[model samples]
Each structure stands twice: as C-alpha cells, then as structure tokens.
Target: MSPPDTDLLHSLSAELSERLKDLLDQALLGMIRPNSASQFAQHAPELENFREAITHSDAKDDMDFLRNFREFVPTTNYEPYRPYIAKFFATPCKESDVKNMFAPGLPYCLAVSSMTSGKSAKTFPTYRPAPHLLHHPLYLSFPHSEGSTLSPSSLGLWQVLTVECEDGQSSKVLPVCAVTVGFQRMQMNWEVEHDKDRIDLWVPGKTDPFAISLVKSYRAFFILNALFALSDRRVATIRFLFASVFVNFLQYVEEEWPLLVDCIEKGIIPDMENVDHVRESLEKHFTANPLRAAELREIGPPGIQGWAVRVWPDLKMFIGITGGSSAASVPKVTHVLGPSVTMQAPCYGSSECFIGLPYYNGDPNTDFKVLPVDGVIEFLDVHSDEPFERVLSAWELVGGGHYEPVLTTRSGLWRYRIGDVVTVKGFAPDDGLPVINYLHRRNGGLEMAFGVTACTESQLTNAIVSASKRSIGQIIDFTIVGDERDTPITYGYLVEIGGEVGEDAKMAIEQTFEDLMANNEFRVAFWQGRARKPTIRLVKKGTFTEYRRQKCDKTNISMGQVKVPIILSDSTSKEWFLQRVIMEL
Candidate 1:
C-alpha cells in the first residue's frame, strides 16, 4: 500500500512513523527462499537465450555458460560497444535524443554508472527485447511492459521517501531542479514556483554528487546561494537534511556553520542571489511568530554533539550512502546529526545493474539479498586461483565466502565481471537467497610487495582517519602511491590537511598506521626486512583539488563526475602528486 500523504509540518508525528515502518515491513514479507528460487528459474531461459544470441557470431555448440563465456563474447569492457548499444535501441524522438543516450525502445530507463571505478561513466541498461526484432513469430507472446517494478540496482530512493524528515516532507519533490555548486550538483531549486514539499538541505541526486572540485572556495559560494534562495521555514530545517555522500555533507557543514547559526538565531534571509521573493516570504513568516527564533536557539548549535535531534526535534533519520570507503566519515556525520538519525547503506548495486535488496533483519553492515529478477548472477571466489572456471550460481554461494559478481543482463552484457568483491554473510531466514555485503574493489587497493598483502580502500581510509584523529587535526583528502624507487619498495601516502603537523605527531601517526595493520600478514614481511615501512608525505591543502581540475580539463569528462584516484597507479599521475609534497608527515 502507498504511504499516506504527510504534511511537512507534521513529520515527527508518531502516526506517520508507524505507517512508514509498516509499509517497509510488508514489502519484505514476500521475499521467501522458495519464491527467490522460483524467480531465478523463471528468468533462466531468457538469460540463456540472450547469452546464446549475443555470442552467435562466434558460436560454440557445447560451450559452458560459466567457463566458455570469455571465449565467445567480445571485450567485457563497455567503452568500445557504446556506439553499437546506442544504435541497437530506438530513439525517444528523432530530433531530440536522450541526454545520457538511452534508447526509447528499451524496457527501462538508462541509469548512469558511478565513475568511482576511476573510469568514465557508462550507461547501465537492463533486459528488454528490441522493438524491431519483436515482429518475429517467436516474439509474439513477449510482454510489452515498460520494465520490472524493482528499481535497477541500489536506487536509494526508498530510504529517502520513508525516512522521516524534519519538515515532514518526503525528501523528493517533483519541482526540485539541479542546483550546480562548482562541479557538484544539489537537489534544490531557487525559482519562485516550487513544490510545497520543498527539501531543506541536500538530497541524493542521479549521481552521488561529491565531485572533486567542491573545495573550500566552491563550498563558500554554495552556502551563500543556499542562504539567499531559502527562507525561514526551509532555513530552519537545515539541521535535519541528509546529504547523499558523507564527505560532501561534512564539508558543507564545516564551511557553513556560521551561516547556519545566523539563520537560526535570527530569522533573516540575506539578499545575495537576487531571490527577493524568498526574503519577503521569510520576513512574513517570522513576523507572525516572533518567538520562533528564540525557541530555535534554545535547542543549541547543531555542530555540537547530540545537537541534530535537539535542533530539529521531529527528525527521524539521516539516510545517505556511508558504506565502503566512506565508512570512516560516519562518526563525524553522526556527531553532528546525533545518534537519533539512523544512517544506513540500504542496498547494494553498481553502474552495471541493481544487484541486491536490503535484508531488513541483517547486520549493521547492511547485507542484501541478491535479487534474481534483476539479472542472472554468477559469483567468482576471491581466494580461488582460477576464479572464472569455478564461478558459483546464486544457490551455490556459501556463508562467509568472498565472491566477485559476474552478471548476464538483458542489455546484452554477458558474463560481465563487476570487479566488486562482496562477502556472503548468510541466507535470509525468510528468503533462501544469499545475503551479501560489499567488501571492496578487487584490484582497487594499496598493493604491498608484488601483491603479497594488499589493503582495501576502506582499510587504508580507516587507518588514515584513525591516525589523523589521534595526531593530526583532520585530513582534507589522501592517496596512496607505490614508491618503486626504494630498493625494498615501500608505499608513499600523500595527505592534505588544514594545517601543518609536527614531526613527533607525524611519527606517532605513522606508527599508529603500522599498529593498525598488525593483523595483516604484511607485518611478517615487514619484520623479515622484505617490505619497507610506508611513509606519509603532507601535500598542500588544495593539491588534490588542483589535480582533479587538471584531470577534468585533460580528459574532457564532466568535472562533476571526476573522483580522486585513491590509489595512484599511473607514473604520470604519481609524479604529479609527488611533485607537490610540502613536508614528510
């Protein structure tokens, strides 16, 4: 059943919370193990036929779907086939094409893949029979539906809609337009005509929207734009809004604390972005209730511990993506939002396909049940030497096993290796499907001693966060690069912080990083004098931002999608970062 239309003013009502919770519970009721198995079997014929048809040019009669897929399908990489994929589908309109180049004839809309893979964005499409090909007799009974009900991959929209907002409005509003802040985009509109269910702060966009170009300068301008465009009611709700990405949220708060306080302490909208109507509306709202400003100040500053709920008493949850590498930033976000806001990853997916649904009773890591209806999934054991040949199906996965997923989708991507490694937590009691948690990217980590012991991006990020919190004040950004010049071959850490860190503090941080990695087998190699100790070098504060700007200019990709390469692989990029080192931390 659809949730009752809630007033933004009455978001904190107990009635509303219970209703939303009940809706979520009903959605999870039908996901039984037998049902999941039946769903997989139902899609098997379509999956097998698609695989066969795509590889027909290089047909192998007795080819095994698991083992021989690599031999028949062209390159698994999506770059070269872009032109063909676009041409294969029909256009929405002859004169005006889709912005992301999704063909109108496809069953579902194209979702933009996250550029977090350190590669350009690719269009993620799912199963559908080609319109022209449907004229054949065999295709007569095929369904002419728009698409499946399930959103392709980790859409994260469900969390936004159900999670209680301070103003009682669903996070989404139809009239909300994309507000560009430097290279980043915010889900807000400054126009006079806007939906009544307006968002107070940032909301998740089509992309994560945490671009590399959103530095201090851009943040300052973004704050001013927000202040000028919003009135007392919207400004009052600032303390309750959830940002799409944790780092982006933290940066925004750090840069705009003073402005936030001013809006609360006094119900005044500064005339900055020429939105006079907003200022007048706020003045009228404040005039009606002169004591509202004082009442808001009584709750105290949001930057302080436990102030999130105190500032906005009705706020139910802080929903956003805080898993994977961004896990380190959770504590900081919680410190501001307080423990009342329930933060969660909600689902697991990628640019390629929406893979899993959130298991409600799962662990805090947000384990998900693989949705067989999305596509045919194959699990490759991470520890296996010959992973391809030993690929496991959905039912073949065992609890505690780490496997990289290979998906065969209707969009014509057969046996496409997703590169992400997910750990099989266990099967859900209700649904017999494997419950999995995303671990890290296969090759995306700090390499040690010719791949003897590589640390995942999250591990590296955790070490940096822990060490920085103990010694250095806070880090702006960081990256790990291989130091091939050293005889023993050590790793070099490039860190950017607000101010200088003393030698003693730097030494303490480096030691702490080593101590944190004591559990890893790399410690034995280090003690045996094989792998040298990693060094930490402090770069200028804006070095990473400058690198991103240069990269965007060179690659000609949108600056908004550019992400900092956590592990510097190329010699040219490594040299560029090394050249800007200010001190050896």
Candidate 2:
C-alpha cells in the first residue's frame, strides 16, 4: 500500500488528536470508577472463596475478616520472595515455594519484577487474566497479542508491563509507542491464527536479530511520527520508553543527520542491517521526501537543542513515570524536547500489582485513583506516631495522610509491603476513593552518617542533573551508593557521560553537587567534620547497559525484567560499579 499523502495525514492527525482529547477528558471525569469497582467486586469474593478453601473458615464480619486474613496469611516483605529468584535458575527448574505455599494447586506464570530497587529480582505469580483490547477510559486500545503461555519476548516492548497468565495467555496494559504494532510478531516469526484459542510462541536462543530490528523500527517510528505530525500541524502526546533512551536516539539523529536526510530523499533505509522486513512500511513513507527533508533542515540544527520542538512543533507532552531513579532524565528531556513539553506520570504501580489509574486535575503531580480491584490495598500510614501496627483499610484513608501501601492480590500475596510511600490527596469526587500522589520509594532516600535521610530520590536526582548540566558532560546514566570504606560514611555518585570531562570539570561537578545538597542534614554533619563530603565519579559510556546485561546473565531473567539501579544499596553491586569507575572527584 502507498503511503498516505500530506493532506490525508493531516486529516488523520486531526481525527486522532480529537479522539485522544476525548479519552483524556473522560479519565478526568472519573470514567474509570465503574471498572475498578466491578473488577474488585468480582475478585474480592473469589479471593475469599480461595482463602476459605485453604483456611477452612467462613468469616463474614469485619472483625473476622481482619483476624482471618492476618492470622491465616501473615503480612510479607520482599525478603520472603528473594529465595524464589533461584527457583527460575535451578536444574530442572520448578515453580517457587511461595507460589505453592500461598496459592496451592493454582496454576500461574511468573511475572519477573523490574529490579529497580536493587540487584535482586523478585518473581511473583500472576493469576489475573490478561487485559483485553477493549475500549475503556482507563486504557488505550492498541494492536497487541491476545494471550500466551510464554512471557513477552525480551525483544518486545519491555517498558510496557506484560501480564502473563497460567491459562496460555499474556496481555499488555500500558500504551507505549503504537507504531510497532507487528514488530514483535515479525521479530519472533510467530503466526497468529485468529481461530485458535491460544497463540503459539517461541523462545529464541539468540536475540540480536530482534534487538536490531526493534532499533530500526523505533528510529523509523519516531521520524515518521514527527514528520507526519509536523505536516499535520498537531501536537502529538506520545509515551516514551525512557528519557535516557530518547536522549540517546536524539544524539544519534544529530550525529547522522546527513545520512538520514540522504536515505529519506532517496527512499532507502539507512544501514539496512537485515531489518528490511521491519522498516519496509516506514521506508514506503520515507520515499523521495526531499521536501520533508528540506522542511526538517529549515526548522533547526540537527541536535538536542530545540530539536524536538523543531521537528515536532505540535508535540504536546511526553507521558512517563519520572519518579524514582528515572527523575534525573527529566531535565535532559526538558533540554531536548524544550521546556514547553509537560512530563506526566499518568499511572503508577509495579509488576506485583497495578494499584492506581490516572486521575487528571490541574495539579502538577498527576493524581492516581486507587483501584484495588486485582489487588486489595491496605495503607500503612507513615505519619502516625504508632505507624508499624496501624495498617488502615483503603476506604478509611483520609486526605493529607501519608502511606506505605500494602497489597493482597489474587496472586496470593497477602498484605505485601510494596516499598513505596505516597501522599494522599483528596478522594475521587465520584467514587470517594482516596486519590494519591507518589512521593518516593522508602529505600531510595540518601542516608547520612548519623542515620538521617538528608536527601530524597527527587532531591538527589536534581542535584546530579544540575551538577552534570553545569560541569559534567551530558549524562547517559547515573547511580549513587553509600560509601562506607572509612569511618566517616559518605555516598558515591557514579555518572556515565556522553563525552570526556577534564579534571577541572570533575571538581566543579562535585562542588556543584555539594552546594545543591547542602540544604539537608548532611550539610550540618559536613560542617561539623563528622561526615565526609560526597564523591562524584565518571564511569564508562555503556556502564549502565553492561550492568543490566550482567544482571540478566546472573539471574537468568530477560533484559525486559531489569532496570538501571539508581541507588546501589547492595554491597556486591556497589563494589562492581566502584571497580569500573574511570575517574573520581
């Protein structure tokens, strides 16, 4: 099929923009309430039945409910699940003990946790059915697989959460970049028979082909998405994989602008690389677009500086989870995409459970409507004087309450502390459910020598970003670890830069970081000579990529299940990164 013309593309863009606007508007109006309630109503009873079958109790009252749940199935932390990581790696690999212990005789597929917290990865059983491709306010309908026994191919969009079920099925919930509709299928060489009950999947021994194909498809997707959006004069709101990945892509485009222009003008794929099948459709659109090339050149220079705005002038915002370790990349996104592009985290949760749905308001921090459907939510109020024992129910939560959410899901996790802390905003007007905003992870805060949390994840991220922007080169990735090599404990900031930094630049980076971080308890300790000043070090360009690779290798988990650890709390990981440091300040 021939590519759509500029005029047709413009019309399509207008239609899409309107539809997107309508969907977002519905979300703000609490359209997600019914689904949350309905799902919860359905799952809550089934869970009760399961519990009754196990514990042999028909507890009906609230007192009975609390007693039965607490006594039969005790609250849990990540430590209890850590041993299960080895279950996946054992000879003649078997299911985890937690799986049998919690939900005995229940079939489940392991959803590998994104190891954002530390080096260890947690394997959680998923009993919830895959999300259907239905028109719902809380979700965006896109081309995706129906269901499968196999987990998402490591080659698939790892950034998007994939829910794998025991009943030979898998489904992705989040709306990632929509352009790669058939890319996964093509990469895996899988045939989807619409008539069949389940899809046949394969595990590839080598993933290089899929990885190469994905890169090509994404490059084309970005360029074409921007090109058409530019022609249509519409601001496109796209979900990005990460700010760091986007930054890296922009850098590549800037470096190879001439080649890109030449390829587009000649209707050829750049660096072909056996990805012809992947880029075939994209190439058709790129065909002899000299006019488009000229327009692209006229907009701005081929670099990060105002480049995104120049290419995608109507680009509205980049939606992503910018909390936790991903915070540092926000400044880079602003620098590249220009300051006008709003960065928003519409949804919040982890692999363990999908806790919150997007609740749009005027506030800068996106409000999430607590949807305790697939999972039952219990809040541990962090602000209470007697915090440990006082775990509050979801409905009992009040505005201005600070909480650490505990989840009990169909997966058989009973009151599991998810390691996150959130601040309760007001309740949702329609449902009266507590609307919350993510604050930070409990363990992500920077600890000082005197056992005081001097800086939060956001504060620490800001300091690193600010320092890098001022003195260090463009940051590719970074991590901070507690340095306890000596008596006066300090933290180490290891950053991977795009370019080399001089000795003066290194000292300036460290000094700038110290100044930015001085507003906290660490400053007082530093002034009193009780604590050593924090150190900054530069790692190799691909240090983070290597780290992720090593993690995958060690755990026998897919690359999709790993993330660049922001706060290296584990001694082994800290020592590994420290050994790879090229320079220190």
In terms of lDDT, which candidate is strongest?
A: 2
Per-model tally of clashing residue pairs: 4, 5
Candidate models: Cα lDDT each = 0.47, 0.53
Alpha-carbon RMSD to native, per candidate? 13.6, 11.3
Residue 257, model 1: Cα distance from true site in angstroms: 3.7
Local accuracy of candidate 2 as per-residue lDDT tens digits, 1-585 = 112221111112344445533433333222222222222222443344435633454433434544544444445676654554344334433222223433433223455566666654456644423344112323321112121111112333322323333443443232111212222332333323321221221123211122232432333433433333333323345454345544544554565566666665566656533345445444434446677677766764444565666765666566555655666666566676777766655457676766776565524335677765546667887768873456676555666777999887644565679878897877544445567778777667766677777766656777777777777766777898887777687767888877567445656556655664566576776678766767788887667756765665555443333466667787788888888898776
- Which residue segments of model 1 deviate by more than 4 Å? 1-75, 86-104, 107-110, 125-244, 260-302, 410-412, 447-453, 466-477, 483-487, 496-504, 507-530, 538-565, 570-583
Model 1 global lDDT (CA atoms, 0 to 1): 0.47
Q: What's the distance in Å from true for residue 220, model 2?
A: 11
